[model samples]
Target: MGNSFSELIKNFDKTRDYMRDFYIYGFKTRNDFQYKSLRTYDDERRRIESWLGDFIKFSNSKKGKQISISCDSSKIEENPLYNAYRCKSFTKNDIQLHFFLIDILEEDNFISLNDITDRILDEFEISFDPQTIRMKLNEYIKEGIIISRKQGRSLVYAKSPDSFQRLAGNDSDKITDMIKFFSESAPFGIIGNYILKSLDKLNNLFLIKHNFIVHTLEDNILLALCQAIEGKNYVSLVNYGKSHKKTEIKCIPMKIHVSTQTGRRYIIVYNKQWKRFSALRLDYIKSVDILEVCPEYDCYLEKYQKNAVYCWGTSFGAKRPKEGIEYIKMTLRIDEHNEKFIIDRLKREGRNGSVEKTGENTFCYYGEFFDVSELSPWIKTFTGRIIKLESNNKQVENRFYSDIRKMQKMYEVK
Candidate 1:
């Protein structure tokens, strides 16, 4: 329907425009999209329907009729809009000139601008001005696709050396195999996947347990933020929270954390205005554009490293005298003969903590961690085994008791 569908991998100007609008501001009525005329609106609507007809839905309400895409995010195996970044559009002139220059230029000979233009007209019957040809050649030179050399008073152009198989003959096979694995496993593996596909060596040998669907479409954004982090730069993020309200923030991105169980990702950023580390869900971030390198980026990194010692989960506690520092000690009367695995789990899950045998069958897991209240779910698993539970935070103790009381009342246990 659009130029993106015509090309395999490049820019799709029309597809980008239509998709960008729908993605950023979804659930909009016909009146919400203010076009110059009704015909223009209908044209765009038709184009959108053509691309995502299966996904799109219409609804009527007191707020007037609206159009939306009903997608079960958890069930989505592939993001449809991923093609927008892959397929790029090209002009007729670009196609003609690319072939013209390739045909005229030889590997050994260096041809001048005037000679190249004359040859293009004589050989291919296509007459492009010297200025247009010069511009295109200069662009190619910048891209390192072609080479230019100064011969006498004139400048000449030639093709660059072929470097397809850059690896040595001995290690080419090993390197190719590594690329195949990295293409599926790495964070920005799509680039490697593209290369592998071109070589026709594409195979899904590694079957990952948590194959995140959003990771494919979100790779472009992830790459930009990663680059910014490496450069010690700030990123202006247009993020949406649980409320679906969009807000913009200029933050110095520090760390990226991924939950192994959920396959969810979060980025920890230092908010300049708030003067604290704020964690934002990666999926909720609508857009991120890199800004100038921050002068205090290194300082922020050092501060984060120091502060990370207290962080239990993703949350960095609020500013206070001690900053919500607390420890939770969960002592259980575990019957090792019946459930030896419970003792093993305590030691395994307890990071930089101790699991001690207080009695023949009792074990005490004593750990000081920030946000111990977040560990309530894990504590509940040892309901029958829990002999004693203690925490420095009063709120945690109160909530633990409150939950036990609720369970007792519900089960009507004496």
Candidate 2:
């Protein structure tokens, strides 16, 4: 037999980790992946190519062949990266049983597990144990591919009627529009993409801006976190960072926060042990285990709502002030007549920040937050227009000037 087996993966986390390194980070040569073995890297590269052959591109680099994912987000209806998650592992019997069971139930009649086992033996000349058949049926039932109902004492399973087909038949245009929107905008949107494929439809109607395609990889994580948040349940999450050391954290999930600039997603949670609320990056979260429902869920949620107002971006400041506050004030040189949009943006995108006209063609934008540093990126957007920047934290003020000086030196500005 040849060395290569099926490209499908058994462990998604390993694939996801490698994918982020090569695909998201991009231009990673084989040698760049030093943590993993060369063989393992090659296998993962091959697997990624198998799943996203069209989008996978490589070029010769000084170090080695630089692997990267290349795709035009605007042209694509769905993110191709999501296919990584769908590449589930299967055995020979799994494929065989899947077809056998579906074919048996495609008749649209309810059949018992024993009946299925017998049919497989007589019709397909293959014998699957009744228990194995039952398990497969249960899985299909959960997936909505099959439906089970009580028939006398035992249960009977039947292939589920095509709900998508029926819905598409009634309002094809509306359904197409909705699916197109959902596939691009919503979490676990790849399902919408699958539905669109089934309908033989394309997303020709809408153009989405600021769609974060990478966020789809974290959809499974989001689903678990959202479910826990909905149920007021505490969750234990395995958060992995640069060192890849797993740190387990137990917290009460409050809300999901998405950045408009980078399209990154974060879950704001109340860390009971720390007695503080913090936002954890969704991408960094390796796994989430739903724990028991929080008894103080409501109280924590209320406290979080108040705490959220102080959150400028995601960081709730490293050092909570004695007065429980930090502040930032930025003076901008806006042409009051021509640059009203600048003032408008300050009001629109500033969150809890206040913008006021201080003098002729000058505006002051100020906000009180838990962390002044969190607003630095937004502060930098008005680089040329910034007359002065003041903050209670000296580090925040120093860092702004430090970054400005670095940029000036890089650009060779006097």
Candidate 3:
């Protein structure tokens, strides 16, 4: 959005990087910092504490005063950042101006800037300057919170028309149901929350089992990234590495990928300087700016696709094929009559694994992947059923046995 947002309130999104970096990688000492200034860190730390006071902790040691967040983030129903983002703070002038302007404009009648300022002074004892009121109203108009129109030579203002009024005559029951489902389910569901709240009948109907509330914070960045990807444009990303250090990179954003298991999201970008594909975790991505459209972006994907088959996670890495692309094939012994469930699950979870019967109760699976090691966990699920497992990479097969032996030794000792 515009500069007017976030600053008006001591919001969490404003101090996002300050809190997240520190939360993930806490400060052992005040001076050991990547932030520009100590004053900047103090300001942001205080802002973060205001929202996450419950989770904040401090310690005194040889490393000086250390700050860290203590919470099991996965268990939280809503992201605390979202809760703070929703926390709206206002100045004394903001409160008075809203009431003075809204009370007059509630009737849907438009009036000039002079009339509004006069109404505040004469009707409410609040003496606000006419020029100041005009500027304030202009900000509201830009935000679409209020409407300003030129009625002949004089400019007039009013509260923007209610969209609810247009939907009032339609099939309300159906509309309310649709609104309830989407408001709880869609990204930026908060945007639809106001409308959903208006329909009291729809309240508390949805008890989402797997709501990813933190995804709401990523909506703006995701939109920008997706827009750049669709337009085939380069983007400048300010991101943090595993070391919790800041770095900026210019890359062509090729695609967005999400994990079905965890619902974590990532953007796969091709780094021209490194001449390879790198997947940036969307949660770790601080900000993105779409650069000019690039014609050669898709050419990077041609190389990426060859390697993507081996990518078990978003770790496509900085270069190709010392991280070799290989063929992986396996044979599982599944009795058709007794193991319909296992057979169905294998088919459902297998992205592109081909299934064929090689013997009476045995089935063969064939697939090509860059890294067969990635499929180890899924392969382990079929422990007894895996009669034969072969791959071009010998290390993968050896690691699988090593894991199984370690597990056996632990259980035997127990």
Candidate 4:
């Protein structure tokens, strides 16, 4: 049909791949994408422009016109990238049947499948097989768009009662506020953003600080991992590292950890074969397939929770001690008169660690974690105020000093 044309997309992964490229490595001409046709690039660029015209920008480069999306996450309440999820492809029959079925059930009457099909042929002058109509109706039933009841020997379908009016009764404003907050704060918040769009509402009520816009790229992968964890299922996934080398792993999905400082996300999973827990970055996961349920899911979950307090971040540590623990102690010089905030910070970000006063304007922080190395960066933050830092792992302790010596050499410090 002269190169089929449609604005909506069928495969979201293709859209996601192109969108991520555009979002991450912007300012590229169509010629930059040597693998795809110019037409393909044009179509996707057009599609994204249609969705995020406000954020789309163009500039002239020496080679050609460059297209890019410029979005300020802190300036906007909702993620515009979420628009990619809302554009869905539909066949001619699917669209036609949707209107026909909704128009037929508009009168609040239950109609049998055969009768519905006949009405479409007669009233709408469109004919679809009765079985096709039945399947469509069943699909709608599962989606809560239609309700069905047994009528004699046949099943009949009718439009489900709309709950929008009920939602608008009293607490609708509060509900909208909740959704506004959720759309920016929650994982898979694109769903909430879609709901807000359906309701024709704008988020004028809330603003999220430190919102991580790039994280929306990993939502689809996160959704799969969450489903697997919730069902206590094993997942087989393709993971790739910085070098883009692929590795296949089968593990029990456990938890999702988000870093407050960097806004990166990781999926914590347990590998039964290795008998160890490891965290994989969400972005590194290429694909995931849900597998059979893990019968020892609860036992593994309890063990993880018990040992989680010892985890500095997502790592279970390297060269774990025989006792499965590592210790760290830091003494910081604080001006108790004015630097109580430092002590408060040590207490706040210490996780399961303890802080106690050792002497006037001096405090000692003791922590036991699965990996003391992971805490090195955090410890470095208190560089000037650090009186002494010690770790049970000599490598971790020496590495800290080694880094300081390198910095001193670089700065030509005496």
Per-structure clash totals for the candidates: 6, 0, 2, 0
lDDT of 3 by residue, 119-179 (tens): 8888998889888788789888887779977899999988988556555657767777667
At residue 293, what lDDT does model 4 achieve?
92
TM-score preference between candidates 1 and 4, better one:
4
Q: What lDDT does candidate 4 reach at residue 2?
A: 30
Tens digits of per-residue lDDT for model 4 on 1-414?
A: 136555688888777777877776687788898688878888888888888888888889898988887876778877888888878988888989998988888536888888898899999898898888888888898988899999999898889877665656798888888888898888888878877887998788777778777788788899899999999999999999778899999999899999968777899999888888899998788899999999999999998898788898998865443475889999999999998889999999988899999999999999998888889999999988988889888998999889999999999999
Rank the models by TM-score, top first: 2, 4, 3, 1
lDDT of 2: 0.84
lDDT of 1 by residue, 72-182 (tens): 544443344543444555788888988888878877788899999999999988889899999999998997668999999889999776544753357866776777777
Q: Single out the weakest 10-residue window by summed lDDT for candidate 4.
A: 316-325
Model 1 residue 203 CA deviation in Å: 2.0
Model 4 gets an lDDT of 0.86
Candidate that scores best on TM-score:
2
Candidate 2 lDDT, 181-228, residue by residue in tens: 888777788888888876787677766666667788787899999999
lDDT of each: 0.74, 0.84, 0.73, 0.86
Better of 2 and 3 by lDDT: 2
Which is the better candidate, 1 or 2, if ranked by lDDT? 2
lDDT of 3: 0.73
What TM-score fits each model?
0.70, 0.93, 0.75, 0.88
The RMSD of every model to the true structure, in order and in angstroms, is: 6.1, 2.2, 5.9, 3.1
